[model samples]
Every structure is written in structure tokens, then in C-alpha cells.
Target chain A: DAGITQSPRHKVTETGTPVTLRCHQTENHRYMYWYRQDPGHGLRLIHYSYGVKDTDKGEVSDGYSVSRSKTEDFLLTLESATSSQTSVYFCAIRPQRPSRGTGELFFGEGSRLTVL
Target chain B: AQTVTQSQPEMSVQEAETVTLSCTYDTSESDYYLFWYKQPPSRQMILVIRQEAYKQQNATENRFSVNFQKAAKSFSLKISDSQLGDAAMYFCAYWSQGGSEKLVFGKGTKLTVNP
Candidate 1:
């Protein structure tokens, strides 16, 4: 186990509501990523943080945003929930020490979101 | 842009048999990494195997191995002695070595192991 925990294991919210999902890791990994998994679609990266206050957009970062204020915590927020945002979100972390291709990713249990 | 493709949407194999899942990727970068990740019913992603483009030899983790055909741009995963536990969604991913750590993933293949 990577000691990764995602808050609000499941959530159901109405459209236009703001929702934030928290990902906490005890491993102190330097790289943290937020991704969404939809049916028939593979996991798509939304955003990732290399360090505290350092973040970058991913392939599917249009409606979602992420912030990492500390090494162990990464947060993903949906400014206004949409029906299209209803999917499972996952948090992943990779150690900083090993070279680029050295470390494997450790993922959280996942958070299921439903927007009506 | 890098793209990963898993042509098979679903596959089934008898327990104790061997099965190979196909995955192909398109990327112009020469230096990169290929990986196979397994997502079980728990929805927890687990790394099955990884292959570095620079390495000529294939990567094998226990019964899981990858056939890396860099020239053909194909990376396929083969599972030997399949077990019921192997039933899950398998995703093939690609990551460039150009400092961008984000991975491009395939749609995934749902594998079912029957006894």
C-alpha cells in the first residue's frame, strides 16, 4: 500500500455546484497527478503538480484545476460541476529520487462523482 | 501528441492459459517509456510492467511480460498462466522523456479469466 487516501469516496452533486476532491499521500512523493476515468475511455490526465505551488495542465485540463500547497497533499477542484464531469477520479504519485524512468506510480482507491 | 491504442475492447481466457493483449502507440519522440497498468474491480491502478524505449530487451514482471517492437511502434502485454485474479481492465500507457511526466493511456482492454 502506498498510504494514499482520497477524501469523499463517493459524491453526488447538482450541476453548477463547486466540488473539491482531496488526495493525501503519506509517502511524500514529489510528483502528484489527478486523472479522470470515464466509461469506454482510459484514464485522462487533468493536471499534475511537480512540487508545492508548481502545477501544469494535462491533456484534459479544460474544466478542472489542481493545487498542491504541500508535498503530501494535492487537491483537484471542479469550479462548476457538469454532467460530463461525472466519472471516477484518481490520484497518483511517483517518487522524485529515481530518474525519470525509474519509479512506478502509486494510485489512490479513486473517488466516484456523479453530477445530475 | 502521443496516442495509445488498445484494439481489443474485451477478451476472455481460460484459467491457467496464456493470453496476449495488444497495444500500439504513435509517438515521434525516440526516447520514451511504455507501460501496462491493471485496474481491478477495486479501481486501484497497479503497474504490471514497463519498458524503456532505449532498452532492447523486453520487460517482464512475473507472469506479465511486454513485447516491445520499437520499430513497429507496438507494445503488447502477454500474461502467462492466467488466474482469476488477472481479470481486470488493462491500460497501455506512454510517457515521453522530454520532462513531461504525464502519461497518455489507451482506452483499455477488459480481460476476463474463466475457470
Candidate 2:
């Protein structure tokens, strides 16, 4: 298992409230990603960071934003919590120089969020 | 755009039996990578196996193996002598060799190992 930790393992918030999920990694990996898993939708990428201050949009980055000011911490924030955002969010890390051609992702336990 | 498709929503296999999970992906890029991730009830994504598009040989790890057919755009996972520990949601994923390392995952197939 990777030394990755996600804060607020479980959360319940109102629909209009803003929520922020934090992911911390001790491995100091250069690549970090955020994904949401819902029934029938599997895991959809919300956003990812290649390096500190370098971020990019993912397939489902509409209402979500991510920041990586420090190498060890990556944060995902929901502008306005919605029921559709209720899902298990996972944080993953990969080495900057991948040993194998296939980049394998080491994930955190996951954060379960519910929007009422 | 790249897309991964896992045709089976759910699958069951008896203990000590073999089971195959199918996956197909679409990509215009010539060089890429394919992977199988296992998400147990705990919801931790674990890497099971991986196959490089440029390699013709399949990838095997312990009880897991993948049949990679680049020409057909098919990547399937075969578990030999399935055990109860193998019961989980298996996802097929794709990643480009260049550009970005972020993966695109398919709707996972739930696998049940019958006791």
C-alpha cells in the first residue's frame, strides 16, 4: 500500500454547501489524481496534478477543482455540493519516472461523501 | 478520445475455478497502456495486471493474467483457480504513453467467488 491518506473519510453536507477533501501522500510522488466512483459509473476522473501549481481538467471536472501547492498535499473542492456528487472519492499517486511503461496507480482508502 | 468498455456488469465463479473478464478499449494513439484494477469492498484500488500496447506478449501476475489483442483492441483478464479473496469490482483502465499519465477507467465488473 502507498503512504496516501484522504481526510474526512466520511462526510455529509447540504446540497448548497461547499466541501473540500484533502489527500496527503508521504511518498512525495509527482503525479496525483482525484476520481469519483458511483454505481454504474465506476471511477470518473475529476482532476489531476502533475506537479505543484500544475493542474489539468479531467473528464468530469465541471463542478470540481483541485490544487497542489505543496508536493505532499492535494486538495479537491466542490463549489456547491450536489446529490450527483455523492460518491466515493479516491486519491491516487504515481511516480514521476515510471519504472514500467504501464503507469500503475497506488490509491488511498477513499473518502465517502453524501450530499443531502 | 479514449474509452474503455467492460461488457460484463457482474460475474460469478466457483472456488478453484477459472474466470475470464472481458474488456475492450478504443484509442487513436498508437502507443498506450492497459491495466486491470481491483477494488475490494474496502474501495481501495489495487493494481492486478498491466499490458503495454506495443508488446505482443500477455502479462501475468500470480493467479491473474491478461489476454491483450492490440489489433482487436481487446484486453481481458483471466483469473486461474479463483478464490473468495478475488471477489471484488474489477476495472479495466487505459493510459496514454505520452501527454498525461491520468487513466481512463471503464465501468467495473463485479466478480463474486462462490464458496
Candidate 3:
């Protein structure tokens, strides 16, 4: 238990609507990541934040946007939700600082979303 | 670019037996870290084991151990005396120390422990 949690453990929405998933952490970790898991794709990174306001894109970042205005919160927004975006989203965190931590990432329970 | 490949999409083992999940990666960088994560039906991803590229000896944790072959670019996970609780989707991930803190994961291997 790394004090990581994702809101709305499950959600269902119609296509073309907007959706946002929230990731909250209590560890005050420096790095927070958003990933999506599918049948063939295990866990593909969507976006990640390094600090309070610094974020970067990952391999499968399209159709997704992230913001980290605070260290404890990382948000992933689907501007316009689509059928393809219906998948389980996971939030993960790790201390990127060398002396402060190892390379291991603690993950949240994951949020399952369905779009019709 | 870095990529991880798990050749076996599915595997099964009898309870109290041993099982090995294969993982191979492609990376030009020398310094990196590899990890295995287990996700059961609960959908929670838990870290199973980790192996650093610079470590010569294999890494092990209780029943979970890894065979690291740096030159061959292979990292495999071995579970000894598997239990029914070990049934889950096992994922192998790669992360370069010098690169972004992001992890590249393979498709994963679904493990079934039969009684």
C-alpha cells in the first residue's frame, strides 16, 4: 500500500463525451504515471508527471491529456471519450530521485471505463 | 527505443510445481532496470521481482526469482512451488536508468495454477 488511489474505480459513458480520471497519492512521490491496459497491450504509458507542474508524454499518449498542478494529484482527461478509449487505466508512482528511492513503481488499483 | 517481448501468452502449472515465464528485451543502453509485475483478477498490479542490469547475480524474492542474461538481452521469472494464489497475468517491464522514468511493458503472460 503506497498510499496511491484512483477515483471512480469503474465508469461508463457514451461516446463523444468528456471524461477525466483522477490519481491521488499520499507518498509525495516525484514521479507519477498514467497507463492503460488492454487485452494485447499489457500496460502502456499514457502520460507522466515529474513534479508539481512538469509532465511528459509516453508511447501511447494520443487521445489523452494529463496535468499535475500538485505533487499528490495527477489527472488524465479524455477530451472526447471514444470507444477505443474504453479500457482500464492505472496510476503508478515512483521516486525518481536516485538517493531517495529504488526504481520500483507502486501502482493503484486501476479504473475500468466503458464507452458505448 | 526500448521494447519487451513475452513470447508465451499463456501458461499453466500444477500447484506445488515450478513455472518459468520468458521475457526478452531489445535495448542499446547498458544501464537499465527490469521488473516483473503480477495482476490478479482483482486488477491490482503488484511488483513481483526486479533485476538491475549491472547486477551479476540473479535477483530472488522468496518463491520468485529471475534469470538475468544481459548479453543475450533476456530476463525471465521463475516461480518455485507455485500456489493457487499465483494465478494472474504476469507482466515484464523495462526501464533505462539514463532514460525517462517510464516503463515499457510486454503484452504479459496469463498464468494458471491448477489444483
In Å, candidate 3's interface RMSD is 0.9
TM-score of 2: 0.97
State the TM-score for model 3: 0.97
| Candidate 2 lDDT, A1-112, residue by residue in tens | 6899999999999999999999999988888999999999989999999999999999899999999999999999998999989999999998755573457788899999
Off by over 4 Å in 3: A97-101
Using Cα atoms, each model's DockQ against the true complex is: 0.72, 0.83, 0.83
Question: What's the true lDDT of residue A42 in model 2?
Answer: 87
Kindly list the per-residue Cα lDDT of model 1 for residues B1-115, writing each as its tens digit.
Answer: 8899999999999999999999999988999988999999988898898898999999999999989999999999999999999999999999888767888899999999999
In candidate 3, what are the lDDT values of residues A3-109, reduced to their tens digit?
99899899999999999999999989888999999998899999999898899999889999999998899999999999999999999998656653367788999
Chain A TM-score values for every predicted structure, listed in order: 0.94, 0.95, 0.94
Candidate 1 residues lying further than 4 Å off, grouped into runs, are A99-103
Which lDDT tens digits does candidate 3 get at residues B8-89? 9999999999999999999999889999999999998988988889999999999999999999999999999999999999
Better of 1 and 3 by lDDT: 3
True-structure lDDT of candidate 2: 0.92
How does residue A38 of candidate 2 score in lDDT? 91
Model 2 pairs whose backbones collide: none
Please state how well chain A of candidate 1 matches the true chain A, as a TM-score.
0.94
